[model samples]
Target: MAVNKVKKVFGCSECGTEFPRWQGQCSGCKAWNSISELRVSSSPQVTRNDKLSGFSGMLESKIRKLSEIEIEELPRLDSSFDELNRVLGGGFVAGSAVLIGGNPGAGKSTLLLQVACNLSLNETILYVTGEESLQQVAMRADRLNLPKKKLNILSETSINKICDISNQLRPKLIIIDSIQVMYLDDLTSSPGSISQVRESASALTQYAKKNNVIIIMVGHVTKDGSIAGPKVLEHCIDASIMLDISDDSRFRILRSHKNRFGAINELGIFAMTEKGMKEVRNPSAIFLTNKNNNTEGSVISVLWEGTRSLLIELQALVDTSASSIPKRISVGLDQNRLNLMIAILHKHGNIQIYDQDVYVNVVGGVKVSETSIDLCLILALVSSLKNKSLPENLVVFGEVGLGGEIRPVSYGQERVREAFKHGFDIAMMPKANLQKNKPDGLKIIYVDKIEDALSKLIDIIS
Candidate 1:
């Protein structure tokens, strides 16, 4: 009989790429000093890997033609929260493993508890909390006035025991309070280690698929906002959603980073209250408030978020630089893109602000990522530079190219309709976005070049 030997290898914590030896840098993710040691067996014998192959006994992999495969629509489990469902692209798919990550005190537990309570009424749900004790969870549920009769709660850190109980209970969903604290007894390393976290998540995901159960795992994020643990943890899960909240705000933004079952980059809004997390159904209304008293730099723009259209307020401030080098700061927007937009303003719009400091902000703490906000941002910059306040009823959105041409963005018609519905009187956009069947009462200004837009702004402001 041949003896089984152990092989020590190095792995990148950022990307989970394995290496034969330790190195200062990870070649996979190009991260500095992220390589860590990992040990595995080099045995020829069939082990747990064979069990997780998702095959039955005496059966081998078979090749099937794509035309022969049957396509069936699977019924999704509704969490009863419209905001969450919207972000999830409908509902949670059966047998899918979802990872929700957030900073500490971002209402991750509160949100999940509320969801589990609402979902427990219809189906069997298991909430396994490894970080908190049963009493703590119970106290929170009671304080939040949530239904607790049907929800099964388990305080376990051992993944094996959790799986054993789950197998017997045969729940429709399993909620792991956190994956970092979960550990396998077979592994000698401590819990929260890279190996433990990766293995534990993999095992839970495999179990979810094999048993047709939904597993929702809560993950902690590092200071840089990336999920804690090997990046492979994200790759193995079906969906990775993030709950974001600022220190001074009570609002929480739930967005998807990865989703195999639905659309990605979907945004959901919620407000944390004394009772629990309440869904913000009309997020656009909440974000568009108090615009009547608009300032010199304030501008309203429409953002295409996931499947819906959102009206956002953009504010920019330009002032003389106090330091030798002017500061270009942006909040709730991309900093690098702010610099590029400033350069475009100088070259195309003929508004030079190289020596002045520029600051831009998106109201309501919503991050604007779409390029459609480019025209709106440029207009806001010009408005601030000239100390001119744009009309509160005017909405602007279009992409500005380096050559000073205003480009059309996606879903222009929908954006225009959303602006019109919000009582905006004027819409400044690219000529390409002009609709044959325009909104009835609103005025649409089609500007093809940056100079034309500046002139229009002057006309509207004057």
Candidate 2:
């Protein structure tokens, strides 16, 4: 056994900031008692091997001109799931590192296993887990009814050891069930510390690019819905994807925040079932319910998520408030935006809601943050306060400005087609978004101002 030199260090628990010495408050985040003393290994550092990946094996280094350089697009390894592929910007690009962060029991492992199995039909994949045993992963695979292939699974945590195995196998793709628990053998800090998480991810990323292997690493999110590790982990990754699940466990939304090759804010819909995650082909049907289409306080809204348009229902309930200042409550929608929309309704639509307790929700627990849903949100609030139901098939989507102007949104044609496919007859949208060729089944009701849309809705409801 080697003697590991240990030194006293101070680290912030809240933001994972390291301090040279102990202090009452963390200077980085300004939190009390957030700093704690830690014993970290100081010496016997894990140095990089230049010859490991031919970085030092090449002779005569010479700078080449941009035109002389050969550019080759890396091949994509399809996971066979279009939802995953689309979110990943087509597929897992060779020699790229993709990081996935999610809450516990959010189907991170299940989705990775499913992907590995799907790709194993033609390529090599290694699924490594530091938190679970081989038997546990095997049981999960069995429960998901995953078809057995050449997919390999390993129960390990040592970063060096896992890298050695990866190099030996030269797998086309590798997955670290989690990067948080993985630690370098020479790092003094324990696994999950700020240093360990950051260093381990850096090493893994370098290995992926050097070996031409795709690395998919799992990460856990903090309380504020951010990756728990150091902020640099996200910066170092080729793509940063998050999987969010609602309380009811009906569907999971996969969102890509950072992608080197694909578009950002790309969304993928999945339904959690006994057989693992199933892709939601049509999100409109899942988010909108026509059963209570005629009910008061329910307004149909079309939201553009990624390249798809989702038809969702905004339900608002209004009642007398006991307090002078009414409480503004919202779910799956920004409270601040809701408040702004309510203020606009009172100012422009002559709908006074200052003393009423307003509660708004997006159906199916789906979150709608796009400005295009602002018009529908205000419509739902006004309809609830007046106790009237708008048209059954009326679909509203457009941004509402403080001056009562209806702003146009992108992908207007796609939103209209999505609404028409769902049997929606009339669409109340911004006048500027009206296309020359409209779908046969849908009637576009263009409104330039909030008052115009409100007048149209109030006429039908009254």
Candidate 3:
């Protein structure tokens, strides 16, 4: 009698590379102990005699005419957080899979739990946790002061078990605490391995689509602030949001990077409290500092957070330094952008502070990526260099070009209106941005060049 020998294949957990045999180091990611036995597949795994049938049968495909199709609004479940609603583009769409990634202690779990409790009022919610026990979740619920509601809690990591229970219950919404710790038992890799994460996500996506259940999955982030596991995980989900906190800031920003159903790059603001994550109603107000005081190196810029307009203060400090090479330190604003603006000021505005150490920070740690704040940044640098304090009730926003020309930005009128609502009396913007329909009760000051801006706002006219 002849005996059959089993052959095993190994896979890299770090980079999802597969190997026919085990290796000490992963050839893909070069990480030690990251490679592990994946599975044992017999050479004659599937015999011709064995018929592949059953399953859910085959799926039918169809196509429809654009004019014949009826348009209807997608149903969304309210998460009870307006800020979250904004970032999610109205609310959590039914049957949509949302993968939220964040660092540990960044409130990814807390935010999801909070939303789960809120949704349990009208919808049945299943909260699954692979990393924590039932008792641990209960303790957190108590700490959060959550009501004893119809929300179901399950502490299992097996993807098969999760799917079975989720399908049976058919809950309106399902919240998975963290997807990294989930795995399919059939796979030989660890829970956090790349294969496990990918398979688990695929299962969740299928479950949501087939059952019409909204699934919210929490994902751990890498040290670089990117979602853990394969980059494909983000693409697999209907929407992906990230929770990020800046160093020495109490505020956390919920930013949506991928959304198939709605807008992308939408933002939500939240503040961490002892109770739980509290959504900030007026996020722009939180970014303002010492509004009454007129300080040098401090200037306000209008920022567009999605469709909403926000007034953010940019603070800069410029002083003579002993070092031959002047230092440029920028936080929450692009360093390259600041450098270009500084060079623009030198060549165009004839305002030179190249030999001085400069530091620019976006107040309250709110990251501003739009080029609309360029003129405001240059103004802050000019104020710092000239030791001039801008008027306390002034708001400035415009795109500054390399030729020292100020350009128009989108939604300029809305920016001015938001600034005025926040008690900003004076609005300084590009002349091109001042359209026919302007807001009332706001002092409008238009300028075309960097020199014009400086001469109009500050005493440094030379």
Candidate 4:
């Protein structure tokens, strides 16, 4: 009797690159330990299965001419959350796949659950949770003060079961608590594994597109802050929203990393309260503190996140260090850039920061990465070191160069408008940014160099 033989093939879980046998690393995608051993089926594997299937079906099926295909506009479903609607490009588009990612306890589930509850009256909503049990979800729903009716909950980890439920119920909107926890039984890999995440995401994406359903999948981030599992998961989705959690937990910032239907770099602010995540309508009011008087080491800067302008407080501390090597630490701002600015101060302004321990922070636990806040950071540091306070109701923003020249930043008009709306009386910015159609309410002051800005602020300080 002859014995049957079987062959195993190794492939990358991310890019689907196949190898003859099991390997320690994937050469195609340069991912470590991503090679998984898969049983090679008797049928030959086709490289272009998805393309061939889609294209061949299009050709063989009843051919509809371009003009013959019906053109219909689908209205977006209102999420009842203004900030979410704005980030989602005028609300959630039907048949769209949105991937929301954040750290643990960043309120990803809370945000989605609240949205589902809010839309329950008009549309049938399904909330699937793989990470949490039904009791856990129910407790949260109760805390949110959501009504029990019309909101369906399913605590399942199997992707097949979830899809089956989706088909049976045919909900208007579907929310998957997390993609990492969903698993396909056909795949031998464990849940949240690279292979499982990729395969599960692909299946759900296909199901969503075929059924014309709006699906929102929550994903976990890696230790390095990148989305966990395969990169193709992100590519297959329609939009990706990244949530940033502050140490204080009072505020959470939602930013759009990718949007096929809307603008990029859009930001949505939410406050984590007992009632769940509540939208912050007026961020400037909450962000702008210390209205009574101006103090040293604190300066207001108008920063633009997407189309919205936020008034942020930039605070710095410069003091003598006990150690031989003085420390340069920054929170919510780039440390390297802070060091470079200090170097420029030492070189051009005859100020020595090398012997001082410098620290910088953006107030309200918000992160400001734009270079427009550079001038404000420098001025705040200088004022703190000299024990001098800036003038009241004054805000400053500009990009500082190594040669001590001030460079213009984007969306100057929007920043100025926000400053004016926040009752800021004066604005100091780059001279190049002073253009036509200036904002009517505030006093716009432009400067060409760091020295010029300091000179103007010095008079007010005295």
Clashes of each: 0, 1, 0, 0
lDDT, candidates in the order shown = 0.88, 0.85, 0.82, 0.82
- Badly placed stretches (over 4 Å) of model 2 are 1-4, 12-17, 22-38, 44-69
Looking at candidate 4, what is the lDDT of residue 219?
94
Q: Rank the candidates by TM-score, best first.
A: 1, 2, 3, 4
Cα TM-score per model: 0.94, 0.92, 0.88, 0.86
- For residues 14-100, write the lDDT of model 4, one tens digit per residue: 677879987787889888877777653243331322321232113256756899877887569998999998788788878788999
97-128 per-residue lDDT for model 1 (tens digits): 99999989999999999989889998999999
Q: Indicate the worst ten consecutive residues by lDDT in candidate 2.
A: 50-59
TM-score of candidate 4 versus the correct structure, residues matched by position: 0.86
Could you tell me which 10 consecutive residues in candidate 1 have the lowest summed lDDT? 50-59
* Colliding residue pairs in candidate 4: none
Per lDDT, the best of the predicted structures is 1
Please give the distance, in angstroms, between residue 423's alpha carbon in candidate 3 and its true position after superposition: 1.0
Clashing pairs for predicted structure model 3, backbone only: none
- Candidate 4's error at 347, in angstroms? 3.1
